[model samples]
Target: MEVIVDPINSAVETLMSGTNTLFILLGAIMVLFMHAGFAFLEVGTVRHKNQVNALVKIITDFGISTIAYFFIGYWVAYGATFFSGAAELTQNNGYDLVKFFFLLTFAAAIPAIVSGGIAERAKFNPFLIASFFIVALVYPFFEGMIWNGNFGYQAWLEATFGAAFHDFAGSIVVHAVGGWVAFAAVYLLGSRQGRFRNNKLVAFAPSNIPFLALGAWILTVGWFGFNVMSAQTIDAISGLVAVNSLMAMVGGTLVALMVGKNDPGFIHNGPLAGLVAVCAGSDIMHPIGALLTGGIAGALFVFVFTWAQNNLKSFDDVLGVWPLHGLCGLWGGLAAGIFGTTTFGGLGGVSFLAQLVGSLTGVAIATLGGFIVYGAVKQISGLRLEPEDEFQGADLAIHKIAASSMDD
Candidate 1:
């Protein structure tokens, strides 16, 4: 018997697939644009002398990351590849291709986060190599386990805790991993010269408030796509995700303003901290729960950033990413359990134990991966610049140019 394909039904399916493909493609573009925010954020925070390097690193890492992800990372994570002929691979209106483009943006973010932590000191080539290794090897391994169930990690968690580990977006997957790796890089790279002089911490003012704020705003706008588009289909889109993100942003801003005493940097970054925390739970939590989660994250960033800079002093993380992305990503993971449960007036079906274990696993993997990768890179090619080079600043020493001619 020959099976007949219905033309009407086939046409409807094609149209729907095309629409979904377009929707996700737009989302990929928005998230890709977030790299500009990351670049500007680092540019504004680092001194004028290092600003060009900051701009260069974000795009360069993104370039390296695309290659790594295309060749290895996507296969490692999803067990899929584009090795097929173009005609064969173009099935489904090339939705899978656009999907890969979207996820690569998230992968590239790992290096963007680290660039801020090690700004003004790290060797550019070594750092790019490190980013390549991370996107190609480290990130996709864990990402495979979490997002693709490559290791049966999700199955094991579901058996033990009555639920699979839930990260609707990537609180632990992207932000936390980036943050912890940043910690290791910052640790190994050490503080900039004169950052801790005579056992007293010295302050480095932001190069430009306007640029920093621009970055924060860009990221804030892009994040709606980052969160909403995680649904990955027009059929699955929800107003709830958008509203939760908005509420969390508002909650974080107000709290950071109060806690930071009107500091412009903190004020701008506060919404980011909130957005970071809400990523894991935005799909499940009520707007009220999201508001609470954002508030706590804002407070946490302010408190921890102050402590890390003024007191800890082991490493100088210029953007405080360890707190902003690392700690808040951890909080986001766990908050998905707390705020995503019926106990917190959320949509429920999450397990606290699962969230705890999954979040911890992400941290452990990030920390250990950071040590191994950065350690090897340091030994092989050297990670930091020479003292003299450091004194001259990254833009001039590495890029052979200044952010502005006025500085020369």
Candidate 2:
């Protein structure tokens, strides 16, 4: 009887571990699918001649990002290395390995975000080199500091502010960092050749509205996995997170429709803006709080994007990534502290002061790292296509094929 009981207990433990591994694997796949969303979003936004380049850049960046993260970035973030025998690597149902896959998707998002901002004119291989360094070094550094408490950052925040900084998903860690880093790249690359003429802005229409809408739809569906799976285990999954994400998405959609005056681009991106903001607080905030946070983000995107496109002459961000991801992400980070308090109908145990400091710290690190990586790459290899190449389009110039050919 004793022998039978022991065997049963061992089997139970093994079953639980396997279940967790499967859960995380599915989540990783969903987030991996979001890269397609990123690709299509950029492809639809850029001009027709550059569509192939957009598709190529996103998939290539993911490949490079995986190599960088698997060999270096994961170690930098968690101090865990996969340099082990297969038997050892397969222990615990390979949950650790699957976890690495999940986080790598997040890290890869940095290049995908930047691709949109610097689309049209950026040199292909040079930007890929910058992406390698960013994923391997810059992103994982902040990820470790916040999520793992690598130094004493979380401890210090809790002691001084009455609570640790809380980012349930990665509003500050992933989105804001990706956004600000994109701002740096966009600034350094400067406006496209015809983006400004005689001190006035020029508008470039999207190549395909249906494709843009499709991209938005895919991201919206995949985001549930992004926000919910950050739990990293089945036992911790929350209905609250799902509900809050829904509310925020609706809020963003309604506001963007009104504020953007029914513009198709804004309409599609509104839900994405809302999702970005809700990622931080989705687990803790009440649905209403999430709604307000999303609504504000939607309005912010429309107004800021319009103003920047018309007024900002120094840089051209084709996708308006800074406003949609960077600024909205910063707001989401702060909103977690505001809405994730008992006073605001949340579970509490978050500090506004800690959130502010943490949010600002992420922005600073990303900005400095972006400039260093991109600036150095620019100095060494140059950042953009030649004038002749620009006229010919990246597909023909770099890839030696257009997205479509009349002869074919």
Candidate 3:
């Protein structure tokens, strides 16, 4: 067969062909591996008896998210919009399907964050049901309103503030949403047994710091795709995004070492803090700015984690999502406003006030939304496991299998 192609048409066709598609596919694969990292990290942080339960929750979330996101989540989130200049794109049904698949992977990541919070004690059936609600209904609603252009508060902000809100990689949309959900789940679940006694918090140390470290490393690698792939437009911006991500990770690790004084937990979490912090501005900030953002994020994680452990009461956030994702995501959003350069499309040349407002808005919406949804769920069916189940270990109580027993 002889192929005939116009020069301009051929160029555009090539841009959308083999190379770009492969890059997108590779990015998806990297993000997918992060689920494994989450499983290891959650299992390592919880009691040995609860390891299987935590693992099951992680696996179940990944599976459920894939299906939920494919069905209605993708369409609702990215379907149509007259705002953010996405009206034209959404008008055509054909292109909507393409955009749906491209964005669904990111949507799936939100529920994964919620999984860690409900670990160790949540019933698998309820957790699975929640996963569907988060990905299919909850997550898509937010994604549609914020990033999708037509439905979110961003359009109002753009109209009222004279500039659009920014979230280069989903600092607010993905991380904050997940963190809020985690907070709600933990709040409803209550403190683990003996976590608070005589009005003092008891620490439950990580069982395998090595596993946590390994998981952190894997997540760090996967984050490159998470941030860079958001550009959609392939160019020098992608390379810059990759570089900024690496530098931020380095900065975060160095900051952790300086503050932690040889604590493995600090080292493991530092890189994650950096990655999350940089996500909001990875494509817009200078390399030096990326480093500073990461360093601050690392420091924040160290401080916040310690504070939550010593001062916080009644809540045990098994995997530290609030500090890692919630706090750092906030930092990223604000940093994009402060340190972003005109060399890239950032706040139309940077506006600290604007960035602060955007970050704060994201935080408020995510937190309130989470509390409402989780509160309703609690009222209806209750969110936590039975106290006896918690004491006996969720694996045996809920799944009727123990980690050791499985091996035997």
lDDT of 3 by residue, 289-331 (tens): 8899999999998988788867767667778888888888888
Would you list the clashing residue pairs of candidate 2? none
lDDT of each: 0.93, 0.93, 0.75
> Residue 165 of model 2: what lDDT?
83
TM-score ranking, best first: 2, 1, 3
Clashes of 1: 0
**Between which residue pairs do clashes occur in model 3?**
145-152
Q: Please, what's the RMSD in Å of model 3?
A: 4.5
Q: Candidate 1 residues 1-408, lDDT tens each?
A: 123457777888999999989999999999999999999999998898899999999999999999999999999999999999999777899999999999998899999999989998899999999999999998998899999998899999999999989998899999999999899899988888898888999999999999999999999999999999999999999899999999888888989999999999999989999999999999999999999999999999999999889987777898999999999999999999999999889999999999999999999999899989999999999988999999999988999988888745
**lDDT (Cα) of model 1:** 0.93
Ten contiguous residues minimizing lDDT sum, candidate 1: 1-10
The residue-by-residue lDDT of candidate 2 on 19-128, one tens digit each, is 99999899899999999999999888988889999999999999999999999999998999999998999999999999999999999999999999999999999999
TM-score of 1: 0.98
Point out where model 2 deviates above 4 Å: none
lDDT of 1 at 169: 85
**What is the lDDT for 274 in model 3?**
90
Best by TM-score: 2
